[model samples]
Target: MKTITTAVAALFALSTAVAADEVCMNASEMQSSLIDWYGERPVEGPSANNTRLWVSDATGSWTLVRTTDEGKACVAAQGRNWNASMDASDVLSEIAENTES
Candidate 1:
């Protein structure tokens, strides 16, 4: 979970960094589109800052979305091959440790 939180944080930063090309809209619309278009559903979060992780079981795809207090939402990041079993904290720690060096 810590790893996911770190990733969510990074994604949020990345979104702000690349705001010019970001696809943003009303939060509800983004939610509906993720489900309708990619079969993704909220699997985790609405974290301390309203970030959420959405994943598609059928497609093995995942997305990170960050919503603002005013109800705007943006796709922070997205990728394929999501595996719940692989979401171990230690694995994430190792990845982060390696990244720092």
Candidate 2:
């Protein structure tokens, strides 16, 4: 019984590790996609005045794109971890605060 319990625990640990790794990989891929889309683009200033945020899960990959003012704010506030799980509006608020300062 002890051995069986130990084996089950080991299996559970392995499963958890695998799931974490997958999540990390997905996050990294999403970051890469966002960077590619916004490379060399300023996230603030006049260029960002009309920006918008775009979220997509196409290609089995989650991606966030910022286009104009609000989009620029979200990216600036949240950095590369921006995704579907994030509250983009909250990020915009942070950006607003930052800009006011």
Candidate 3:
């Protein structure tokens, strides 16, 4: 009845949040030989290089993604390390942790 419906809705919401929060904190986890990574070079406006488009990986199991063009970023796909590197740590999570502290 009404209680069951509410419980189902709550479960759905909780599951989604948990899935998103499983963000891979390591940059190396974002790479896979199955898919390709691009620089996204744009001729006009801010360089597309500032933005990245990481697409499908083998079996497409988990996640990691980062973008610097503002707005926000969500973990897109995760795999063994395979791209440019920088200081380690989940970029978005680190940002959130820093801001909260």
Candidate 4:
């Protein structure tokens, strides 16, 4: 009985963990398909880095939408993994270093 309970719990945990991974919704094969899904978001000032982040007012959910100088836009990520409150240089560096072009 104990063995069966443990097995069931393990399976449940594995399933939940697998479902938590987030995939980019606005995938780009060619450059043109990368238009902003949420439309034009506001910015702080002029000459910003073509980056628009949409943070949900209710859920604290967030999505980063960045447009390259080539006019290609894509959702970089969606999670509680960002904020304008602090510097995320280390996290950003680790991600940049690990990602493959």
Candidate 4 root-mean-square deviation in Å? 12.6
lDDT of each residue in 1-101, candidate 2, tens digit only: 46544433332232211122222223334346555754422232232444333333232122223343222222322233333343445444434444453
- TM for every model, in the order presented, reads 0.65, 0.28, 0.23, 0.33
- Compose the digit string of candidate 1's lDDT tens values, residues 41-76: 886657665768787768767676879888999876
Give the Cα lDDT of each candidate.
0.64, 0.34, 0.32, 0.37
Q: Would you list the clashing residue pairs of candidate 3?
A: 63-78
Model 2: weakest 10-residue lDDT segment is: 15-24
lDDT score for residue 35 of model 1:
93
In model 4, the worst 10-residue window by lDDT is: 10-19
Residue pairs clashing in model 1 are none
TM-score, model 1 to reference: 0.65
**Comparing candidate 3 with candidate 4, which one achieves the higher lDDT?**
4
Clashes of 1: 0
lDDT of 4 by residue, 1-101 (tens): 46444433332232211123533333253222222432222322212555454443333334445566665555554454333342233333333343325
With candidate 2 superimposed using the best TM-score fit, by how many Å does residue 47's alpha carbon deviate from the native?
13
Off by over 4 Å in 4: 1-48, 80-101
lDDT of 3 by residue, 1-101 (tens): 46544433332232222244654433333333213343221111322333233422233222234433453444533333222321222322332343342
lDDT winner between candidates 2 and 4? 4
